[model samples]
Target: PTLRTSLPSSSPSLSPTSIPSSSPIYISRSNPTIRKPTLAPVQILYDVTSPKDDIKIYFGKDDNDGREGPPKPHEVATNVLDNSGKKYLNYNDLGSGFTVEVLDKCVIKGARFYPANDREGRDPSSYKIEGGRRRKNGRWRWSTIKSGTIRLPAARIKVTEPKLDPRFPHAEILFENQREFQMYRVTFPTLKDSDSEHSMQIAEVELLGYFTGGGVSLEGVRTTPISSSSLIAESSNPVSQKKRFKSTGTDRAENLQHSFEEKGPNYLLDLTTQYDMVGILKMNGVFKPDHPRYKKLTDKTGAGFISRVKNDALVIKPAIGKTVIRGARFYTSDSEEKYDPSSFVIDGGVEEANGEITWRRIRAGVLNMPSARVDRKTQNIDPELHPHDGVWFNNDEVYDMYRMTFPETKDNSVNYEMRISEIELVGYRSTRKLEESNFNIYDLITTIYFWRYEGSLTVPPCSENVQWRIFDRPIRISPRQQATLEWLIRAYRDPDTCQRATVGRPRRDGTGNVDVVRPTQAIKYDHLQVHCTSANY
Candidate 1:
């Protein structure tokens, strides 16, 4: 079924024709190319969920470099088969037998498989564990790395390879020799002489490898390798302690600089650092408050601030040229969860030679802030509660200079204020190299887990071009910092009006009320892909 988003009559209309022709589009989410260096043994585990009695697990390079399409059977490198000849426990049951381990010398030293069932007519003798290396010309050279017959209930096959050269004290040295690839394929093979049909099902596929401190570029080229000795030294200590920075009404420069030096420029700290807060606009009005349609901004139910990135814009240029952003990671501010933004829109485009900024709609989605279970007795995030951290947006088109508008929120009764600590953007980069352009967001977080999907911007000119990568973890802020966020929001003034901006609807009572959350919308599409760091960060 085709997926569609239903917007309110007052909301902007979305047309499929609005999608830009030159947009960057990724055929599929590829596994993380970078691998952290490790000295310990590495293991890749497959939790099969298939009901089929026979299955084969293939590991190595795919035909299209494991990017464009599914893996083909002929492109197998290292493979293991589960042919017990009889149904065992559930596919994901532990000890049902499917595991692989690589020793420090970068060799496939061991593998375990479920033993074949011994029945009157069953043949439980034939099984093979094969390993191969890929040639530079994109061809796989096959050889049986290890081979043995199955045991009674379970079989553990171990192989001993030649010792490594002591001169080069790194596991990557072995990888360089074999030219190993990083791709996995699981298929249900047909029975030898049976007419039974088989289906493919999988519950989980896990690859456990040591942190090599080395990384692979987007093009599958290996970067400079780090030694095991250095990796050991680095892993013993934490990278850096999280520092708390506050933004008071008067102390902006010092705090800003400290944050940049500590967290780097790409880490989302506050709106003031990255964007220029243009002004506040009423939700119902399309034009700015200064426009003739809405001559002056009024206290309304859906009023939000508009902000644009700084002069030196942050651009997202994927190697493919265009991409669809589906979602994002929104960190909560110090204020109560009620003040968090419930809905927003992200726009991206290039800046013209003139001072003007050209805009194209990128993504629209609701911000689902996790509940802050603040104990009345002691004001701190309750560790016991789930989702007390960050919310994921797995939903885009590509844009460099992103313009985000927070129009609606979770609660409308209170004055709306967005208090986000950080907004991490995760995805692939083009060959032009973002580092050359001073892109610091990459490698900000050691291990990143995210969900990717297709969605539209939540606001006007709702373009469906965004590729959302919402971080699974949330950034924690202190109570003092939360209070600081509230202070900053109220302190902000409209540059055009030279008047205080209205954050929420005005009530008759004298008491203060703040709410800027947009209600959750129905999900139109269901396709979601998950990506995580390959190494155990």
Candidate 2:
């Protein structure tokens, strides 16, 4: 390599180039006119054309030109096209041409000298010293020579694996690069502050240097592709700790500790004293019909109907084994006034009490009968306070409740419970054998007994469990009251368009979905108590 200076000149015969003698070096470039391709290990490409402005090349090993000055354009160009030099390419081999500038050089020819100018004979600024006069010895004359430097930019090296994919070479210029039609410059001041440093002595800085798809080896070589296995290798020490579960000791904790409930309350089920049965009789005002499930809720008539009554009624018979409470009877008692228990009327439908209510073991012989009463008030049998409001149901304004219906007693609006007799459906008052097919007075008497055991008041939070007292007697219901209940079940028409309310399932109402009843809750235990306060005369 040689350090070259220049003599400046201007002539029309030579190509006019704006490249400065102090131009950046492009160590790599290729003669596109030839097919002798250059590789990264041989050359580096650079931009030297100064048509627009100065091209900034940074300082680094890639641009390290050991010559006393920056690499010249000819050297840069020759290096790219040359096959005799080292395989390591310079800027010219990379295909980016270098810029060449013409410089002025002094020539000492015997006493008389000629001006060193371009072929056009024009003197560049360098050829004319700032204040030199024309009287100098001819031997000291200077002339301009075509002088320029080549720039070699930093480049990436890679183990080109084009065989992997000929279309996408393993190592080549990356697509969408800043090097593509973009200006890359290198500027570094290796000495003192800007103005104090010698232009040729500063160490260069790096602007761009890369090797495609390679890792930097400890030996200062980037030659490996990143892979998943090596990336997931963890350090020797544990990276994280596992979490443990927490245990809470409270109500449930205590309960869990208790293995079992050995023994406690033993109920001597006195089926005869079942208060729910009495309450049902009083509510329905009559007997309940027969049912198949016996104790379970089912489609059986005796298991479903309910009742309640007003001051003008009395229970005649609650069905018993289909025998109308089997000789069921009611007597009136007016402790404050003169009253005959037998004379107290029972709507003339109830048969005289033959036997009492009883409970028999599942397999014990024949079942025996025991007396039935409302808190031992069998003698107090009389009219109820709230009679049916003309419908088959009695409205309990205070409780906001209604005993939907009853069956056996040929009654309506009476008891909420079914007599044990209702359950067995063994005995029932003949009542002229009145049935659903007939609206005869018998039909008006006893109603089915059971209740859904739910809440009342078709309103919110509908809290329940109020004791319903329906009479085992059946009474005629006015047609108007039945109509009221019917309205509640079906949809009402919009009076304007006369659009009937779409009943059935909710939503179809043209409004939204809604449930007429509440869902049931699981029950583990229940409690009850009956207090008979002596009535004031």
Candidate 3:
């Protein structure tokens, strides 16, 4: 858990004028563009520290009925069992630190620190402050805000302002050019004396910032046990029986469709591939040289055919390490008649060796899929469940793709396709901690029964550098809610005239064929591996 401390009650609500003019700072809601913060003393997050057992109380706001009055004394503590009933603010050695993150978007004007009394060499002398903002891809990037050393006060002055000169240690520093930010991380790089190995102690840290009214509100952020939702569901019996196949069969596909449950250890994939020249392999059908629909299927825009149905795409934080995603398979919802066809692409990446992870979209994360004809002859006679209109991509790229289940009608009538506006992307941090996610560990892990086979991208360029892993375990989705994603895959339109790119063309979902599952293709020489919680199944 990230270490955080709140302000104490009984501390007076300060106005900008309280500080000396040398520090010139302002804290007011007079600017309509920047609203006043709804919450106060802001949260403090700690890092790189062990304790020497010392207690310090902060005086600020009270938690009583969530009301803000005067600054009162409050102890900083985590309710964890080891530190239960004890409120000690201690940093074992040097280079220990903490951060203050505003609950909302705000402009930080200035800050002040109050050192703990009686701590001589343990008091922090030099510190570094950084500002951070969230990127479009939902990752944070920090920039240096200020850094300086302060002189320890001798008398018991309630509040003392230290002279901060970037160059005096030597130059002058100020926040005259305040920018909107959501976080300010403060690191105590050095104590009063470099020769001393004593831990640092801080009684209180305060920040002055006005809300920008634009960032995510940390007030509603919470951590609770993951329940049955889009990510995972409770099962009386997770998996019944498991079987393998030297060659694909009806029973194997059936078992893969509904028998297995999402659970167990997660295996990391090597997802460092380049995006271009890469495509997902279509297990059921690869684009054939002589097919009549060849010209349209090979068009630069893969959105031509499936553009009629609203399609949705989601992006999830990949598991730690190199996440090698060769191929993805879908499962039928408990209340659905068929599995919705979708696509996924690697968009961004992060290296976990460093404690911090920053996500960025991979260049070649796009996929191309040629429409596979649903068998019109056997539409109702023999309903084909898993149509082979497989999602194909070239293996030269690395990215994370999240394909959501389309909504189904309550009466099970029409299934909607993808839509541009309806496409959803949920960012995640590769761990089981749900503080920033809607999924749990169980939702990301699955017992996969897979067989590798050499295949070609089912679209144009017909590149054959594809290694496919056809999973037998099905990923479940709620049928009734899946169709809501139909608008995202709507037909392509002319950017200039706003007309359909291909006039009179049938939408991917409009084809009368219900079975899109490609006919069982023969598997070539390749290894078969089943990854699960237990080998017994």
Candidate 4:
């Protein structure tokens, strides 16, 4: 499942005067558009986790609630344990141990655990506590802060010291280093000794820390667990997989004000003026004479049909080590709509010191060309397409890229060719200028809303290093344009072997249609972030 964080539509925009001097700032205009919410401080046990599905987790602000059964609809557990004279949150069935994730980043100096019953109250003989933090690149890293065996009668246990008195009922474990982290996990020994059985019963757990931000909110967090068997079945036969379409709008769509920014300058719009078109591979034929697509043996072959557009690639060398490409804008051709690429892939790479280009995939998905909209008065109307408007991907992990092989076009049998009047690439700088031009990339762009996530390239050697941002809207094309696109030929197929053959004779048999689109790929993991923007209109 995708975790969606919707920015408030009516969120207060940060004025130029309100920005902090310490923050890294970028200048779009004298008064650039920027909006971000204020961060706050908070301390709370946001979530508790256990690998065992049967174990129940209870948490609340009040320590004495006596409700029973599983947690209420949205609340954690309700029951409390009264051991001796002290009270603690009731947690039983110690399959092993559990983890607790705090609301936000904080420095945890220590923790207090109140045991329930005397037998179960005895601290684990051997225990270890671990901490985890999320990196800027969207990966989690964990390390152990302290680990050791607990002895009886050691009440105040400092991680550095050997032992202390007044232990058992309540043990305060202090750490040496007060490093900041988002979550922590505590594990216990699995040995089924007399003391180890049902030893996980705890009355209350308290963490000591200086936290930042309102405790982690689980409001929009979604989780979908995929099994290995489902993956195997999808890989074995892709056609059997269900097709799904992504829906538009969030609950807060009406109140959110979005701001857009790229790490580097927008050099993609200047490609035609700054870079030279070094190559162009046309979709002509190149097959053998013996191929069945040919009418006669002498008229055997021509250049075989090229499946995808090879000439569409435009390489760039940015000065920065890492480039985050957010989204792209595609333009239609003047004469042929079939020449427009309905689906495409974007790749990013760094020219290594050894002169090898280590490529990383940025995005691979479908780009829908808008069709004519029907009107009540008129039979059909031209689509409201513009050069600045961006066509977005659904961001559906399962079907958006994986299940659908071709663009949602009128005819599936026609061969599609890669044609474009212009292609805009964002978030990079060009090495040198090839010629001079007055084209302004920003002029064509209107306000855009997008969803971003960390993903790998759709093609092979799929490295998990790319950051993807998909726009929320789509560009439009005319009905005639859609028809022309479906009529384009991808390749000439040999009727005999049903393989690609050169256009020997004008034989329609075994003719390949325009289908240069790659199917959507499945999202392996579920860490997705969405950044949305509304149009000025």
Listed per model in order, the count of residue pairs whose N, CA or C atoms clash below 3 Å is 50, 150, 75, 34
The true-versus-predicted C-alpha distance at residue 300 of model 3, in Å, is: 45
Compared to the true structure, candidate 4 yields what TM-score?
0.23
Per-model lDDT: 0.30, 0.21, 0.32, 0.34
Q: Once superposed on the true structure, which residue ranges of model 4 sit more than 4 Å away at CA?
A: 1-95, 120-123, 133-141, 151-168, 190-199, 213-537
Give lDDT tens digits, candidate 2, residues 1-537: 101122223222111111111111111112112121111111111211212222222222222322223344432232211212211112211112222110111111101001111111111111111111133564222222211221222221122211111111111111112111112221111212112221221111111111110111112111121111111111111111001101234443233122111111111100111111222223222434323322221111112222123222222122111111111112111121111111111111212244222111000000111222222222211112111100000111111001111222212223422222122111111223444764565434344442223334334544555453444433434333443454455555667897765443463433223345445545424523233233311
Task: Judge candidate 4 at residue 316 and give its lDDT.
Answer: 33
* Candidate closest to the true structure, highest lDDT: 4
Please provide TM-scores, in order, for all candidate models, with all chains considered together.
Answer: 0.26, 0.12, 0.25, 0.23
Q: Write the per-residue lDDT of candidate 3 for residues 95-175, one digit (tens) a residue.
A: 445544534344454555544445456566776767777789998798887777766554321223232111111111235
Candidate 1, residues 1-537, lDDT tens digits: the string is 011111112223221112222222211112212222211211221221122212333322222222322224522112222211222222221112232322111212232232222221121222333334568999765554433443322221111212111111111101111222232222222212122211111212212121111112112221111121111101100112112333455465445344334433222221222212223222222223123212111111112222222111122222122233322334444446666656555555454455343455454434556664222223221112212222112112334344455555456444444444334333222123255566576635433676566665654455667677776655444333443565466456799988887464433433233334334656666535455554434
Ranking by TM-score: 1, 3, 4, 2
Which structure is stronger by lDDT: 2 or 4?
Answer: 4
lDDT of 4 at 421: 38
Residue-level lDDT tens digits of model 4 in 179-241? 556577655442224243432334344444443221121122211111111110001111111
